[model samples]
Target: MQGLAQVPRLLLSYAGVQFEDYHYENPDHWFKEDKLHLGLDFPNLPYLVDGEYNITESGAIQRYIIDRWGPAELLGKDAKEKAKLESFLSIFTEIAGAAKGLFFNKEWETAKTAVIEKYRPKLEQLDKFVGENKFVLGYLTLADFVVAEDSHYIERLFPEDFKAFSFLGRIRAEFNDLPQIKKYYEQPKAFKGRFFPEYAAVTIEQ
Candidate 1:
């Protein structure tokens, strides 16, 4: 499964850059076998080996791609715009952090109410921030993709809860409509069972 890699993958796809997609079925074994040879200071899964430049860390890798091969708009048009986008990204990360337990916990049902209560305020804040915008920063940007990706599992896990946040649904629809994104979604990489083993067992409501 792509996991953090999906952000860079989507950005690359959006830029129409042809790149290799590698999946490791046994990451632990692979790490032990190739870590030293990979030439990374701190080798990690989902690292990009672009010629001599090996980049680790999802956020840095995504920014590197955007800086080198981007539509520019994705990074924002100016300092102020970039700051706004980054701020949104920060908050999106916060929301994802707050909600991680709900997705990964074996006893999610037992604490579902408490989890919703804690995160609903942030979700509503996001809903208000996103009202009728074409993208998170009024145009396509990394912020939009980050937020969408983070929210996707929750949207699937709790459709009724997410449906109450109409703006999020609209953003998802708009983002999916992009030609490149649509193509990517058509044949998404299988979710890595190691990270999301229960994902398959969870049914998505239509």
Candidate 2:
């Protein structure tokens, strides 16, 4: 459970969005109430229940929030910016999706190192794409939020190998430099970093 799930919280916070948060950690029981207001089933742990609409997929959930609450910066102003942002985020999201299965592996028999080597190129591509850019798009936006969350976790898994992809290192440095990104990331209490047990577990293993 990396803070990858906290992307929306950061994006929305940065966009000055304030709303109630409903959580059902590993809600396997599927005990969500009737599909009325925000009609979402609790079966999906991270489902976003927004006024009779429950979006199970993480990307859709995040983008919808941006499209509605943050019509400008979070998404983009014009077609070019929005398209670029979307392409960038889509690629980055794929990287994260592909990396997670390996990054999250508990196997220690050279599997982790092998996985790192395999995904190093993906990380590099991400780095090169975001090189020297203050944000994913022309400015701070949802793309940055998503990538930051993904990298924050991936770095924890392969800090040293991460440096091998110099671009990733740059991206990491960039996010660290952004006061607003850091501030927005730290604003929401429930989605805190370094405190989550998943993070602690990673540390303990390290």
The numbered model that scores best in TM-score is 1
Worst 10 residues of 2 by lDDT: 197-206
Candidate 1 lDDT score relative to the true structure: 0.74
Instruction: For residues 86-189, write the lDDT of model 2, one tens digit per residue.
Output: 88777777766655655445563355676666767766776677666766554667776666566654676677766665545555566657776577555545
> Relative to the unseen true structure, what is the C-alpha lDDT of residue 152 in candidate 1, on a scale of 0 to 100?
72
lDDT of 1 by residue, 1-206 (tens): 54688788888888988888877777675767777687887788678888888889888888999988988889899999898788778777776665655666667677667867777887788778877787777788998778667667667656786799776667777787988898876765523223344463433332
